[model samples]
Target: MVHTHAGFAVAGRPTRTRRSAVALAVALLAVAALLVLSGCSSKPDVVPSADAASVDVAATVTVKDMTFTPATVTVKPGQAVTWIFDDGVVEHDVVAADGSFVSELMTQGSYTHVFTEAGTVNYSCSPHPRMVGVVVVE
Candidate 1:
């Protein structure tokens, strides 16, 4: 059957502008869906440094497998605490929540911080914030 607009004979379909609008709407919806999905997806995996596996454990906190081993440590005031990145396949860093100390991007070896103030100090790897640890100085 033929379609009509304003009593005029036309094809049995919508106008070009109407079709284009539908197509544009579909395309926009698809783009929006992709954007939402991309935000929900997992983040990129962390890669270990070249010398990560061979480091000694001189640190009180150890970062491995995207986790902080021995997540909490207790010590007396003025005692020194250290953090070592022992994960062979992930890079990490340490930062105190209270601006007390910060470590360089550590993939191996240790970073030492002496706690002089008596309080609880919480820290996490900057690259992997989920990897959290704490130190209690009494």
Candidate 2:
């Protein structure tokens, strides 16, 4: 197809304005690439710090293979339960039924919640609802 606008651009390629426009386009593309490479465009729901992981975690739940390892855990009141995200690049979080705690969507990180009351706390991954787990506090 004989394109009129394409012909005009081609005819104007030697102009300084065209060179400037091309440079601007290249700069914008470079900025976009940096954003994606640095994960600026898709930041996680929660950004944990270096000291975020608790030392007194009683039970650890491994989030992998679309399931929580040791799906049920029994712990005493005031104990902590930690959920580690290990499903490769897939993101997951722990959300309690009673709104007690909600973790950050993460592919590799951990979230800990201390159980203060004596009861069962049920939770599931927000992205994968079928991936459920329970913390039985006695």
In the predicted model 1, the residue pairs found to clash are 48-89
Q: Write the per-residue lDDT of candidate 1 for residues 1-138, one digit (tens) a residue.
A: 767796444965776667788899999999999997876643333332223234332337778888887899887775677676788857787778886777777678777776777899898777677888998888
**Over 4 Å off, model 1:** 1-59
Q: Candidate 1 overall Cα lDDT vs. reference? A: 0.72
TM values, all candidates: 0.59, 0.62
How far residue 91's Cα lies from its native spot in candidate 1, in Å, is 0.9
- Worst lDDT 10-window in candidate 2: 41-50
Q: After TM-score superposition, what is the CA distance of residue 88 in candidate 2 from its true location, in Å?
A: 0.8
Residue range 42-72, candidate 2, lDDT tens digits: 3234423223354457888999999999899
Q: What local lDDT score does residue 103 receive in model 2, on the 0 to 100 scale? A: 78
Q: Which candidate has the top score in TM-score? A: 2
